[model samples]
Target chain A: MSSPATQPDFGSARPGGRTARTRAAVRDATLAELAAHGYRGLTVDGVAERSGVHRTTVYRRWGGVDGLVVDALDLAGEDGWQPPDTGGFAGDCRALAAEVHRSFADPAQGAASAAVVAASFQSPRAAEALRGFYADRNARSEVIVSRAVDRGELPAGTDAAAVVRAVVAPLFHRLFITREPLDAGVAEQAAEAAVAAALAGVFQLPSGA
Target chain B: MSSPATQPDFGSARPGGRTARTRAAVRDATLAELAAHGYRGLTVDGVAERSGVHRTTVYRRWGGVDGLVVDALDLAGEDGWQPPDTGGFAGDCRALAAEVHRSFADPAQGAASAAVVAASFQSPRAAEALRGFYADRNARSEVIVSRAVDRGELPAGTDAAAVVRAVVAPLFHRLFITREPLDAGVAEQAAEAAVAAALAGVFQLPSGA
Candidate 1:
């Protein structure tokens, strides 16, 4: 049961002089519905019913399911836990891996994610949103890897993008395909393997190895 | 519409003493339907309709959609363009990449593959079938990498499993997530990068790097 009035307008300024309380209510309610029903099961009517908001108000505010989903995903992506900056590549990787494990380990988050991925396959808008989510994460990972390169912990010419892809590929493979729990030890091993391989020259040095 | 009599039993062998031509026709029809309708849209009824096979026959043979899909995938996988036996690591990689491109470039094969992947997310049978497919391909790729190690083309102790994973990772990413055409050039570049990096000592090196 979500209270739609509690949901927040992510990064967007409140329109029509809507109060902060109403927006927060709406956003919070939406999150609850998403967690409970998943993307496919969520509907605007549910949001309106749970939030005690008028259906017209919900429609006027969000447009449709896609808009609501986008807003909800934005909120989730932003409010979701962030990895600690551990000051070095290895530590940063461990922190990042732990955050991923935590996020996917939650039943609600994991189901919501799978639902979104499924919906994305059928909807171009949702696909774009999914891409944006990955792009942001990839950018953060690149920063960490670059720091490693700068420290000479990895070769100068390493393909940072590929390395970043490698770091999370196994985690995602296990999560989405195998539906397996991502143990912390598995995360550590993957991170260690990726780092070791990258340093040894897996992605190719900038010039030639 | 499918012919009812043409369905081949996947479990039982030639119960009606049907000729090989009948089984081939049914399998080909199944693949065509898979490409046309995707996994979700495809149904046993539809396959029966398309192949002129009886629904009971299909069920008796393959069990359900998952079983039918497994048969279709097996059929598709058998239509080979395997890697040539290149003398060295670089040559072997090029051959492997070429094979990847050939497989993905085929419209029929690519669509069927995407359908299979999407289905795997929801069905355990599909997941098992997909895993078997990957494992077989992995085994084949290992032999090529092993040859490289023997020839001193790659460092000893190089992780053949990891290298194979890396080589195909981008192609799958592009094929599944990005929904991009996996062109031959992209495959070639990926293969070259993987071999060069692995040979340069990215993973564990042999006694003499």
Candidate 2:
């Protein structure tokens, strides 16, 4: 493992501060545990042990496994999350789809995601964390739509977050419910379908009905 | 509980007969167990006791808990499974979406469905059963697209099953992944967006692409 001295801190008060380093270590340990054992088997002790933090510190800081998982999820959401702005709606949608597909299709990330989804079913807090995580993700991607509107590729009142959700939701269905084959083609289909539907005002909430 | 005699069999041979009665009892008991205890907590002995079938009979017929759940799923899929023929693609899509929403949104049915989905994650046989159930459902709904094709609303050679999958996928995402509140409005949005995407050739798999 690389030493903390070599690691870059994006814009922290102290580049190699003990608190930030400890937080990073704990989050990494949480993800590792989630990927290895799934949420059902995850434990605070395991995370504390793997993170090399005191058990009391772990318990005092996170309070429980759900808290730790939520923190890990927040960290995951923040890192490398900006969707590519390919200048148009279709390109942006496709880029975002591809990025999401790759993340969810990778073995480690896939397992971590599945673990989180499974945990959400058993706990209301996990469910809320998942919703918050996706909401943030969708919000970050809304720039794609704003750019599309500026370029006159879509109408002024298109729901950008809905468009992003539409593009990603099918893949989530396949991964979590249908368990279907997910490939580049699937990503392309999701992007194209969302683009088509958004252009047609299908995602725009109707005035009355 | 009503007598088995009161339940119609929809023209099955030996309806209300002893064997049919036993099967119905077992399946209903299985659903109750699933709803009460979830997939991991389900047991063959528990089902046998609740179903009033002999332990040997339950063991001999279903082989185990997973087998019992699969058989229960088959029974669930077969009963009252038809979507309304609303005479046009959009109407048919909306009706089918509403039906799915109702079934999935009902408390008992929803809990039972969640148990099975959870089981699928841990058992290959359960996964196969889920895939088979959905394949049959998609086949049943293909007529909607076929009629649309006949009416020249959708292009000829549209993949009927793909359209159906697209239409229903967002709801599944909400039910299983996003854990979002699913209302009629959400159902309507899913159906309308799918219809719009289908018309734009988004769901059509390109030749050699």
Candidate 3:
């Protein structure tokens, strides 16, 4: 639930003041390095050199390059985008879908996500972080669906988790495999389609229950 | 459509009769090396030494390690363990879902797929090969869903592509992210859920239309 913008600023001077400035500089350098060399090629030493921070300070704050990458992803504000809380399930899904499309379409986000996904394949810590990121999105969508269920718009015992997966799987597929530019309109259509399916009992209660 | 058992033996010698035995040995060596060293560490000379094939012959057949890896994957076969054809939509889904579960649960397949996915990140040809593999699976599912649509078991304009994705997405998520085993029962439930939702008009037609 921490917004990416408010994550510990790696470049800002810490409470010791000087440390804060160094942290901010280190974070900025990390962003630049990630954009240029990708996650596989990034190193803590490179970030320290680029930011004029001590290697010890960089390590002390972030643990290592993987931690540094996680913080950088956080600092880069990749988690700030959220779907509008539209009243209806369809509207909420559309909003969520559109937001996903816009985020994946953005060059910065797409590159960062790709880097995270690639890194996750090799690193347990990175994999956990990436999973946490997606789980958060899934949780958000679940709330909306639950609300619809409460209002009796959806049948009881609907699998909210499955519904969330249904909504975003296409967007993720496009981002990871196809590398296609996901647009708002496409997201809207996908969202509408998903919601329509869910409402119709495609991902609903089991039989004879 | 090829069964894993019937694919051309990459291990067999080439058309020159005597050369065919040498080629099979070389290809088998390559697979062993890949399983041990992965894509980054595999080398052509090592394969030649292991298989006792001449280095020139290895080069002539595969061009290099990348080509060899591609062929290894191809020779591994394209059969995704399709579900049996059941007349009902739910039955068809259950069959495919079980197949996915079986494939991913197989240790050999799971590891091989992970390696291929990682290698695809670095090799464009590998990426294309991986895409071709999945595209074939998706196309097969699409045909099943299309038949259901024809029987009016699903919406007239059901998004077969989306349905196919929904069917397989959970299994992939479990395999890659959750590291969970996809059991037959889970696959059957997932299929039934998706099919039921689709029948209820979740994915097709406009929202509230």
TM-score for chain B of each model, two decimals: 0.80, 0.88, 0.74
User: Which digits, one per residue and each the tens of the lDDT, describe model 2 over residues B1-209?
Assistant: 11011011112222377877888788878878877887777898889899889989999988998888788667655655455578889998887777778767667666777777777766678877877777676777788888998999998878787788888888887777666788998888888988999999876646612
Compared with the true structure, model 1 gives a TM-score of: 0.72
- Candidate 1 wrong stretches, greater than 4 Å: A1-40, A46-57, A77-84, A90-98, A152-159, A177-186, A189-209, B1-20, B54-56, B76-84, B152-159, B178-209
lDDT of 1 at A161: 63
Q: Taking the tens digit of each residue's C-alpha lDDT, what string does model 3 give over B29-118?
A: 776676567667679999999988888978998899888778765654433434356887777777777766765555655455566666
Highest TM-score model number: 2
lDDT of 1 by residue, A71-100 (tens): 665654453333355778778766665656
- Across residues A1-209, which tens digit of lDDT does each residue of candidate 3 receive? 22221112123222347665565577677766766776667898999899988899888999988887676545443434444567888887776666666554556655555666666665677666666666665665587678888888888788787677656665665555533446765566557656766776766657612
What does the lDDT come to for candidate 2?
A: 0.74
For model 2 the TM-score comes to 0.86
User: Comparing 2 and 3 by TM-score, which wins?
Assistant: 2
iRMS, candidate 2, in Å: value is: 1.4
- Candidate 2 Cα RMSD after full superposition onto the native fold (Å): 5.8
Q: What CA root-mean-square deviation does each model show from the true structure?
A: 7.5, 5.8, 5.4
DockQ of each: 0.18, 0.61, 0.32
For residues B68-127, write the lDDT of model 1, one tens digit per residue: 877755654443323457687777777666665665565665565566677775567877
Q: Which runs of model 2 end up more than 4 angstroms from their true locations?
A: A1-16, A207-209, B1-16
Order by lDDT, highest first: 2, 3, 1
Candidate 2: TM of chain A? 0.87
C-alpha lDDT values of all predictions: 0.61, 0.74, 0.63
